[model samples]
Structure formats: structure tokens, C-alpha cells
Target: MKTRQKNSVQGRTPLVLFLALYQLAGGLVGLGLCLKMIPALQQPSTSTWVGIVLAAVLYTFSILCGFLLFQVTRQAFLFSLANQILQVFSFGVTGLAYNYVAGLKVGVGVDFLTSWVFKLKFSLSSFTFSVGTHTGASFVAVNLLALVLLYLLERAKEAANV
Candidate 1:
């Protein structure tokens, strides 16, 4: 019985270690992208580009964080909470930063897809008034759901262990 338990632990060790490494890599990549966009954010003409870059960075980071949380907690409920928090924070920061850098007097709220689709207007005023796409919202919802599922699975694993 002891040998059996030891073998099981050994078998799971690699997977757990891999998950930890993956989480670290994802975090580093996300941080790097965020840093890379900072300089672009300072330039007035490149503000739109900065927005794009920042969105990509935040999205990637959120996904990675979700993955890490899922691996660690194996509880979807907790993961969902973390993901939702990240989504809201990312959206708020990106929205504010874009407006400041682009010199939008009013404010901007363009979605991921629509921003590229509707390029007819280039004025700072026009861009500022743009609304974001549903895709961003959908991403947040999906992540939330995933976290919930993971939480349930984690609970099951605990029960099985007992």
C-alpha cells in the first residue's frame, strides 16, 4: 500500500511541476507585453496602437492566470472569481489609458473587432465615442464559467482522496 501511494505521488509530480512552470512563463510573457506597450502609450499618434497592444497583453495575462489558478485550486468557482476580477480591471485600465494617450476629450469605448471594422473616422473625438465589441465580454464570461467547473473538479478530487 505504501509503495502504491508513493508511485502515485511520483506519477503526479511531473504534471504538477509542469503546471507551475507554465504559470510562470505565462506571467512573464504577459508582463513583457505590458511593458513593451508603455512607450507607445506616451505617443499621441500611436495611442491606438498602444490600446491594441495593451489589450492583447492583458488578454494573454488573464488567460495565463486562469490556467495557473485552475491548476493550483482545481476549483472552478474560485477561478471564476479571479478571472472576472482580472477582466474588469483590464477593461477599465485599457479604456482609461487609451483615452488619455489618444487625447480623446470625451472618452473611447471601441470593441476588439469593431475598432478595425469601422475605420472610416480618425478624429480623436470619433474614436473616443466608440463602443467595445461583445467578444471581450464573452471572454470574461467564458473564463468565469471555466473557473467554476475547475472548482467542482477540485472538490471531487478531494473527496476521492479522502
Candidate 2:
């Protein structure tokens, strides 16, 4: 019984660790991207400020979600799930705001939702990777994955209870 308990605890360690790290990294990336737009805020309109605020809120949720997930508790899983759902909606709003500011005629239609690209380039001595816009189907997939992870964590907790 002691050995079984130990193994079960160990089994959960990696998943918890991965979730924590993923959240932290995601928060940092989001903050960085938001910072890039700070300069554009100069002489900005109300719409731009609104966009910035929306981005800030979304990224803050991501960071908090990451921290909560690190707790490795059932409560944390629930909170993370809620946060992920909010992030999904906010992501769309933020994208639309930024797109409008940038004068891109893109809309949240099927084409915008489904298009995604990731490219890698290598030279004799250097390697480079490039990705499409920050918001798209790929990001939606990421959010969906996070939601799935939270569900898995919830299941794991339920199993542990059993």
C-alpha cells in the first residue's frame, strides 16, 4: 500500500510541473507582446487603449491560471478551467482590437479562424523560425489544449480520491 501511494504521487508530478511551466511561459510571452504595443499607444485613440486593456486582462488571467495550476489541487483545476474559458473569449476581442488598430480588414470569420502558419528557415550556420499572427486557429488550439489539460488534472484528482 505504501509503495502504491508513492507511485501514484510520483505519477502526478510531471503533469503538474508541465502545467506550471506552460502557464509561466505563456504569461511572459503575453506580457512581452503587450509591451510591443506600448509604443503605439502614443497619441492613441480610445479604441487603442481599449485594446491594450483587453490584452492586459487576458494575459493576466493566463499568468494567474499558470500559478493556480502549480498548486496541483482540484480547486486549482477548476479555477484554471474558468480562466482558460475567459482567455478564449478575450483572445478574440483582443485580436479584433489589434486588427482594427493595424488597419487590417480581417474579420473573425471562418477564414480567419482556420488559417494558421508556422515556418522554419535554416542557413548553413543559422536557423530561424517564424509564425503567423498572434491570434488565429493555432492560438485557439492552444487554449483548447489548456482546457483539456485542466480536465485531465481534474480527472487525476478524482482518481486520487478514489
Candidate 3:
């Protein structure tokens, strides 16, 4: 059960942990992917090196965000908000372009939803969002979802205390 503390941040422990873990996994996986690709991506040219560097930096940001989220820090929320704002454009352009943005392919397809469950057809490397493609995303949905959950939990906690 969640308690209504007098004047502390409203937090739902399980949801917070879930959101943290989600981001943490994202960071770790992204970092691991970048690290794994480095050897293959290595080249003697400056331009080639830039790609590797950018990959490292991107993963680093993810790791930092996960860390802040895990700690439930205000900075984490701010950073996440900023990231989302940027991603809005990123996802929109990529989604609309319907092309691979740096080896990522985005597509738009209608999802067929029936009953309460969303039927899924899963593959080893990826799974369909709902047996369709429309408004393809660069995994932005995960971050957005986590942010919403975090905000909702915080609001719930606030309401509990008041």
C-alpha cells in the first residue's frame, strides 16, 4: 500500500522502479549496441570516426538519463522532457519520411485491434506494434510512455498527501 506522507514527493514505488528499469535497459542495450558496432564501424577517415563518436555520445546520454530516473532526480525529468521535445521532431520527420534514419526504418501501418488484447506477431530481432505499420517510431513510444507513467504516479502521490 502507498502511504500519504506529509510533504514528500509523491511516488509510486513499483511504477517508478518500472520506469527506471525500462530506461536503464534502453541505455544498457543502446550502449552495448554501440560498443559492439565500434569495431565494425572503425575506419581511418575522420568522417567514419564521427559516426562512432556520435553513437557513443547518444548511448552515454541514455545511460545518464536512466541513472537520473533511477534516482528519481528532478534533473532526470527535465532531461527527459527536453529529449522528448527533440524526439517529437525526430520521430515526426523519420516517421513521415518512411525511411531508415541511420540504419533505422520507420513505417506507418494500421493496427488491427480486437477485443481487449492486442494481438502480436513477434520475431527474433523485432516485433510488430500491432500487425501493421503506420507512424513508425524510433522506440520513442517507450520513453514517452515511461514519462507519462512517472508523471501520473507523481500526481497520484501528490493527491494522496493533499
lDDT leader: 2
lDDT (tens digit, per residue) of candidate 1 on 1-162: 776455435433443444334434444554555557557665555546655555555445545544544344334224433433342211222223222111111222334433432112222211111244222321111123223434543553354242
* CA-only RMSD, every prediction: 11.8, 10.2, 9.6
Which should have the higher TM-score, number 1 or number 2?
2
The TM-score measured for candidate 2 stands at 0.54
Sort order, lDDT high to low: 2, 3, 1
How many backbone clashes does every candidate have?
A: 13, 0, 5
Tens digit of per-residue lDDT, candidate 2, span 1-162: 777556446545666666656666666676666777688666986656765676666566667766766555556667656654443221232223221111001113222344544322111111111223244332211233434655765665565442
The best candidate by TM-score is: 2
| lDDT, each prediction | 0.37, 0.47, 0.42
Q: Candidate 3's residue-wise lDDT over 1-162, tens digit each? A: 233232224542565555555555655665676577667754446644654565556556655765665545555655644533332222222323211111121222223233233222221111121212354433322223334544754554344333
By TM-score: ranked, best first: 2, 3, 1
| TM-score of candidate 1 against the unseen true structure | 0.32
Worst 10 residues of 1 by lDDT: 97-106
- Candidate 2: stretches off by over 4 Å: 1-12, 87-109, 112-147, 159-162
